[model samples]
Target: MNILGLSCFYHDAAAVLLQDGDLVAAAEEERFSRVKHDHGFPKHAISYCLSEGGITAQDIDYVVFYEKPLLKFERILSSTLGTYPMSWGVFRESMITWFNDKLWIKGQILGELGIETEKLLFVEHHLSHAASTFFASPYKEAAILTVDGVGEWTTTTIGKATADWDGSGENKIDLLNEIRYPHSLGLLYSAFTAFLGFRVNNGEYKVMGMAPYGKPTRIEDVHKVIRVAADGSFDLDMDYFSFHRSTNRAFSSKFEQLFGEPRVHDSVFYTPTTHPNGDHPDWDRDVAAINQNYADIAASIQAVTEDTLLKMCENAYDTTGSNNLCLAGGVALNSVANGRIMRESSFDSVFVQPAPGDSGGALGAALYAHHVLLGNKRKFVQEHAYLGKQYTADEIKNTLDNAGIYYKHFDNDDVMAESMASDLNEGKVISVARGRFEWGPRALGNRSILADPRRDEMKEIVNTKIKFREPFRPFAPAILERFASDYYQLSDAEKLYPLRYMLAVYPTKDDKGSNIPAVTHFGGTGRVQTVRNEWNTLYHSVIEKFWEKTGVPVVLNTSFNLRGEPIVNTPSDAISTFSRSGIDSLYLGNYLIKK
Candidate 1:
């Protein structure tokens, strides 16, 4: 049976196609629309998935949405009533949006796909997050955890899953418990994100990146806003937060008073000019003090978040008594926290899907519908992030030729890899677009900008010249899997699968990592993707060639996009970005382009 899964009308809209329990294709709407977070109907993504599966809308046997709308509406209605006059403005605005757009998801699906209403199905939001991880994981039985911004009524869930024995056997998931709305770990982090002069959802990672630079001096102040228990369950003071009552603000007056003043958005980051103890005349303590303060708050929140997550994982372990654990949802994307969980938690094995956020919920919804609801046995393993649509050689060539772009064609893969390896060794930044685009927020080998990780200045060059992103934001490393441990300190090489998708951060070897300054952060950790040849051939070969040339098996790798843009999906998008940016060369399939 063919199942179509959709998650949309929220950030990271996406569609997934599953044919006989196999994930055939998945793509995010933002990739096609050129919007960073397209939260509208995923028409383009749906179209691409259908085309990739070689089927029409009528061919789909079941259509499953990622969440239950009416249930979510109920939560909103209750919260609004509970808060009453304080919630009036938000409640009024929410009702109008829901009535006009959200409540009509059924109609939208029916109208868009020309399918019968009976064929459509809905899964609880957190269930989709849990199913996405547990079902996609290699473990037959594992403890499941899902945490994100409020989903319907649940902000977090702890569950258990058992795989089906065969096509006729029983497959099941039991949700042991859940934490409800207005007390979300995601929203708590997002509140800090906004207060730290970053966009809420978009800038949470920035806070994570900035944390390692400073001490967690404000941790005590941060605890005033929320309280945590020994078992990881927690509650927000509510008096310190305004998200429950107002759309315009996330934190309240009490929160501001506790943390002093919020940072002004888009202001310059601060650092002290001299040590306060030493007599250094003409040092600007006034100018440098606030930046250090901002970094300290970032560090404090990151510490609290990691501490809370570790508690949650321990509680999950104690409850389920399972050595294997599966984690999903937006909060799971915190690589630093994930590293801490892996190192500090009782679970021996942990699995997080490539797209752990809402985008992956589409796949989870479909898997949940097929395996749990339909009683079908599991058969697929999501081994790589190449599940999105890919362009054929002809399609890429046509786009390049039609654009009148200057180009050179390589005779074969060997020559292309060798050429690129030479460019990277010479410190030339190059954006690569080959095979399918990655499915998640990370860019694996296929859609990445690569540079020599060994060069100290490579970070500044790529950030300013190509990415146009923040200078402080460190790049990730795409390292050959066999050589990953040489540069990174992995606890267990046997359970290093999470590193394949850049889902975990690892401490860089002190002697080895300092040699590759571009990828290693100031905290001495690197978000690394371990590339195995079987998963991606050309990518592995190029890295191998680079290793041969420089004896360093890692490259400073980042998403192939400019700041505020989604990773390029089509050949045209690649050419457009290449032409506009300061990248040294564009590797589009076997062909190359230069100014």
Candidate 2:
């Protein structure tokens, strides 16, 4: 049976195809559309999945949506009503958007896919998040935690799941408890994200990146906005928040009073900690002092978020009594929080699938239908994140030739790996676009910009010259799985699924932080991606060759895209990025293009 799962009309719109319970293809619409965080109907993504699966929409037996639209509409309608006049703008906009399109999502899907009404199914949002993690996990049974911005009505859910790998038992996901809307940890953090001069959904990671530059001095002030209980259930002091009522603002004037003033968007962010030598280009003491306050706010929120997640994990462990935990939802993308959970929580192991946000919900919906709703035994484990579309060698070559680009072709993997390794050793930055693009926000090895991690200056070179991103944003250390523990404090490195997907942060060993300064953050932690040969042979071989040459088992890795753009999807996309950026070389399949 073929199932087509979809998540759309919200950020990170995506589509996934499953055949006989195994994921065939998955992709976010932004990849093809070139619109960062595209939230439209994922028709392009659906087309790609269908093409990759070698099947048309007619062949799909079922079409499942990630969430129930009616339930979400109900939440929006009721919340606006409860807040009344203060929410008039939100209510008016919501009515127009919902009545025009969102309320008719079922009809849209049916028409788009040419499927009958009976073939369409809808899963609850949080349930989709739960299934996305638990079903993809290798665990037979595990505790589940899904936390994100309000999903329909729920903001957080703690559950236990059981998978029937051998068909002896039934597949199940029982979400035991939930926290509802207007009192969400995700939104609370997002409020701080906006206050710190970052976009809500887009710039939350920037806040995470900025947090390490300052101490959590404003944590007490942050606590005034939200209160957490012993079991991790919490309520927001609504007077400080405007997200429930306003369309433009997430926090109220009172919140500004409590946290001082919000940071101006797009302003330079440099603190004394960032430039201990006082060498910043626009170094003004007053500006640096204000930026430090913003950084402190970022740190305070990050600390509270990590602590809350820890408490929630503890509660999930106590309630479910499971040694394993599966995490999904946008908040699950917080590598710092994930690292804390792994170290401080009661669970012995944690599994987070490659795409843990709304994009993953598409895969979750398909998995939920195939495994639980249809009573099928589990057969698929997401061992790697190479589930997206991949271009053949001829396709890559044709694109290069068409673009009049000079290139070299190598048939042997070892020769190409050695050549790339030599480039890194020469301090040349290379953008690699080989095999399938990753399913989630992380680049992994398939679509990554790689550099030598030994030089601290490579951080500035890659950030300012190649990526044109924030200087403070840390690069991931893509290390060979066996050497992960040698650099970062990850024990049994091969067994941790989050490490495979770059979903967990761990501190560099006390003696190893200085060895790879480019990838190590201000906090001394690295969001590590452990590469095994079986999962990505060429990527692993390149890192191994670099290790042989430099005596370091890691490479500085960032997504193969410019700032504000989705990661490159096609050969043309890769070439365009390479042509526009300061990347020294481009690797497309067996072909290499030099600047």
Candidate 3:
């Protein structure tokens, strides 16, 4: 049976297609629309998934939404009532938006596809997150944790899964327990994201990047202001935060008064000359220090989160005594903290969805419907991330032709690889848009801008020469998996988290002066993406080509986009980004374009 998964009416609206429990394709709507964090109806993404899967809307047996509408409505209604007159304006605005857009979401689905409402099903927010992990995982039964900005009523949950396939033995799922909302790790992080100069939902990463630069000098003040309960549970002082009622967040006037002053995003990233020491620090070194500091905060908060999760896991493990663990939610995306949980926590093995954020919720909801609700089970494994629409040679050629672009097509893969490798050796930046688009946030070389990492100035070249974004932000190294451990101390190889997609940062051999100095970040860590040949032949072959040409097995790989945009999802998006950026060449499928 074919299942259609959807996460809509929310930021990063996305769609995923699953056939007999195996994911066929998944995509975020922002890539197609060119609207970063586009949260409207995912018509473009849905169509792409359907076309890629070679199925129509009518062919889908299950249509599942990521979150439960009723549960969320209840949370808003209750919270508004609890606040009463003090929250009338907030309540009115929220209710109006819900009434105008969200309440009729099912109708929107129907209107978009002409499907019956009966065919549509709703999964609770956190459950969808859990399913994304467990369903995609190799483990049969494992501890589960889901944390994100309030999803319906659940902000975080810890649970377990068991044999849950259907009577036909085609599909299956099972769960244990959950934690309700008004408390969220993601919310706390987002609150801090706002407190910093970055945008709330989108710029939490900037805060993560920036944290590695400053001394956690404000830690004592923060600890006092943000009180931790006896059980390791903490609550933000409501007076400092405004997310529930107003969008301004914790960085209000009172917040500025508390702190010396809010650092403006555009201005402050450069000027704070003296760190807590007498040393001269560039962005990476300074940021590295800050990363260590943030890692401590992340480690501290994550310690509490893991402690709660461990208790929850132990309860579930005792009942099931299962050796596996699965996780979802935005918090699942925290890889540094995840490394700690994996090393120190309760589970023998763990599984986290690569797209553990809300985008994966769509896949979870659909899989849950097919396996749990429909009573069918089929063992599935997503060994690779090439589960999105791919352009054929002709399609790519046609796009380039229509655009009046300069181009070249190689006679053989070997020649193409060598030439591209030569370009990189000469420090030429190339935009690669080959094969299918990636399902998650990572570019994974398919939609990546490849560069040489040996040259120290290449990072600046990528920033000023191509991306034109913040100069300090470093690029990731797409290294061959065989060399992952040689380069990074990525714990266990067999069950290693897929660094192939560039999630977590690992310390280099020389923290300050690593081999790939260009890709290594301010914090002396590289967010590495390990590539095995079997997963993506074209990308791997090109990397091999570069290696053969330059004797360097790694290339500086960042998402094939400039600042403030989603990764290119189509040939059109690829071309547009290529035209805008200072990339030296473009590789769209078999077609290559040159300046």
By TM-score, who's the top model here? 2
**lDDT to native, each model:** 0.89, 0.93, 0.73
lDDT of 3: 0.73
**Prediction 3 TM-score vs. true:** 0.89
Residue-wise C-alpha lDDT for candidate 1, range 386-436, written one tens digit per residue: 988889888988887887777899879989999999999998999899998
Per-prediction TM-score to the true structure, in the order listed: 0.97, 0.99, 0.89
Q: After superposition, how far is residue 496 of candidate 2 from its true place, in Å?
A: 1.3
Model 2, 1-595: lDDT tens digits are 9999999887689999999888989999999999999989999999999998889989999999999999999999999999999899999999999999899999999998898999999999999999999999998999999999978999999999998999687799999999999899999989988899889999999999999998999888888998988888888999999999988899999998898889998678899999998899999998999999899889999999998889899999999999999999999999999988988899999999789999999999999999989999998999999988899988988888887888999989999999999999999999899999999999998889999999999999999999998888899999999999898876899788899999989999999999999999996899999999999999999999999999999999999999999999999999999999999999899898998
Q: Against the correct fold, how does model 1 do in TM-score?
A: 0.97
Ranking by TM-score: 2, 1, 3
> Which candidate number maximizes lDDT?
2
Clashing pairs for model 1 are 270-291
The residue-level lDDT of candidate 3 at 430 comes to: 89
